[model samples]
Target: MNILITNDDGVYADGIFELANKVKAIANVYVVAPDSEKSAIGHAITIHNPLMVKKVNFRNTDIDAYAVSGTPADCVKLGIEAILEDIHIDLVLSGINNGPNLGTDVIYSGTVSGAMEGLVQNKPSIAISYDGKNISSKEYEKGAEYVVQFIDKIKDNLTMLDDTMININIPDIRDTKINGFKVTQLGIRRYENTFEKRIDPRGNIYYWLGGKTVELEQDENSDVTAIKNGFIAITPLKYDLTHYDRIGRIMKEIQPLDI
Candidate 1:
């Protein structure tokens, strides 16, 4: 299998490197990622500015790697459209991210957004994250190892023809023991005091983002709840944002404009 690996945590981060290394043992791997951390950037693409790509060594790893001067999604774009244009990309794997990307967190997660880019191009993708206070290289390795095994299973059996994305979040390795993987749905995870007002030395007021968690009710089958229960959360995400059930009611309320 030909795989493209990327991350929002930058090209030199342990998580991306570990993931690439682990996947390399199973298939042809290519790495293209942002040069600096681009976390919480969502599914943004770099268009106005010129994107720069540089071939670099991934700490003596043999896989072909590049650092892009753009967002995490841009890396996948360049990989498919330019860098490996001729290669048949079987999958795009986007991250063993430093933190959990569960629930509504996926909406703002560049890690998940990176993989979303692949789905846009009709390629299957996976976004993996570690739910730890401080993610170590060991944690990254564990995520990579588990994902590698999962892919192996899919490769041997699943004959999927649809473009889809899988979001996976592994629980913290310390304190809590992993129960196993569970398919889940996205849940609510919003932050209270999302902004903090502050004054600069020059007395200019500025508001800094203070995205601290504000706990809300979540279903037992939610990805957020699964990670909290020591299980690896796997959710199949869709790109369509339409609420089909509300469409008819909305149309009936205002379709034949009277103005």
Candidate 2:
């Protein structure tokens, strides 16, 4: 099997390197990622700017790698469409992310967007993240190992429908023993945002965005709840955002205007 790996954390990040190292033992691995961190960039493709890709000598690994001057989504799209066009990719894996991408916060996550892009191209994809706010290289290695184990176990039996991808969140392994895996849904996650106004050296006013996550009551079968309980959260996500059930009701409520 051939697997293509990409991440918003960039091609040089320890998380991606460790992940590629482990996965290469199981299958052919190709690494294509952003040159710099593109966190929270979502599923944006670079259209205005010309995307420049450079061949990278990815650390101690022999895996074929490239660093793209674009978003995470662009890396996958370019990898499939241009870079690795001749290679038949069996799966796409995004991340062993430095931080958690849980709940609705995934809406802004470039990590998730990388996998989503692969799914858009009709490939089975997965996004894996470690629930650690401040993590070390060792922690990233542990996360990568766990993800590889999980992938190895499910590679043969995994079946996904069209327009769907798997989002996996691993609990922090520093102090917690992983109980198991829980297949769950995306939970509500909100943040209390703060914009701090500051004066620059030249007396220019600037504002920096910062926020803390707001705690909320979550369902038992939610990704957030599972991660809190020391379980790996595995949520199957769909790219389609249309509310199918509401379409009929909305159409019925509004009368058609005749011109």
Candidate 3:
């Protein structure tokens, strides 16, 4: 199997490197990711500025790796279209991310976006994340190991529909035993946003975006709920944003309107 791995955390992050090392044992791994952190960048692409790429030695792994001066989506796009164009990528895996990408936050996740980009190119893709917000860095290897095992288990039976992507979130398992995998749906994850206004040394005003997660009632089968109960959450996602059920109702209501 040939796997292309990318992450929102920069090329130097331990999560990506550890994942690459573990996955290389089972597949031909290739790493293409941002040169610097682009967390929560969503599906943004670098169009206005020229994208710069450089080959990098990725730790103890011998896999081909590149650092891109762009977002996670750009890294995957460039890797497929330009960097590794001659290669047939069997799977595109994103993350083993530095933090959790749970519930509604996936909409703003660059890690998830990286995998979604692979789906856009007609490749099987998955995004895996660890609950690292409160965990130690030493635990990343364990998370990587779990991800590799999951991939190995599904590698033979993996069949991705054209419009779908797989998203996985691993809870912080340092203190708790894993409750195994749960196929789940996205849950509500609203944030109480805070924008602190501040002045620069030169007296210019600026706002720094910051927020804490707002606790809300979640469904029993939600990704958030699974994580809270110590399970690995797997959610299948599609890029289609159309409200199909509403379309017919809206058309019926508007059909009598003259141009």
Candidate 4:
């Protein structure tokens, strides 16, 4: 299969590189990613400035790679729109991200957005993340195995045509004693203090994002709860933001009486 791999953690990130190498053995893998880490950039695209892509080599790997001057979502857009237009892209895999993209974190995650870009083009995409930021290359090997296994099953099944792309967050636990996989919904993962302001040289101001203290108050069958309970969380997210169920009620309450 022609699989295109990209990440928000840049081209040379340990998780991305490790994932690329592992998947190369199973399928045709092509890597196109940001020149540097663009974490939490959301689904931003470069419009005013021209985006550039350059071929680069990793430390010891001979993978076909490109470093793009854009966000993670921009990388996928460029890959589909301009880079590999003639090539038929079968699957788009985003990350082996350094941190878990669980719950509402997907909103600000470049990792999930990269894959979302692929889905926008009617292509199958997968967004994978490691639960911990300190995940090692060895731990990514396990994620790599799981990715291949997951795709293999889907390729064999081919029953669900309406299935949306997935947001998969795998735990960094190396014990392999996982609570298995669960198709979950998005959970609430909000930070108490999202940013911390500080002064730089010349007394210039700057801000740093604080860590998230995940909450599961109103949600039990959610990605956060699944991960917290030792399960590999798979939340099938879509690009559609419409509230179809509440449309009639909202229209009845807000519509003008002119008609």
lDDT of each: 0.90, 0.91, 0.90, 0.86
* TM-score versus the correct structure, for each prediction: 0.96, 0.95, 0.95, 0.91
- What's model 4's TM-score? 0.91
Local distance difference test, candidate 1: 0.90
lDDT by residue for model 1 over 80-151, one digit each (tens)? 999999999988999989988988889899999999998888888889998887788888898898899779
Judging by TM-score, tell me the better candidate of 3 and 4: 3
Instruction: Please give, for residues 53-104, the per-residue lDDT of candidate 4 as tens digits.
Output: 9989866678779999999888998988888888888888999999899887
Candidate 1 has a TM-score of: 0.96
* Model 4, position 255: C-alpha lDDT score: 73
**Where is model 2 more than 4 Å wrong at Cα?**
201-204, 256-259
Pick out the ten consecutive residues of candidate 3 with the lowest summed lDDT: 132-141
Candidate 2, clashing residue pairs? Answer: none
| lDDT tens digits by residue: candidate 3, 187-256 | 9999899999999999999999999999999999999999999899999998888999999899899888
Clashing pairs in 3: none
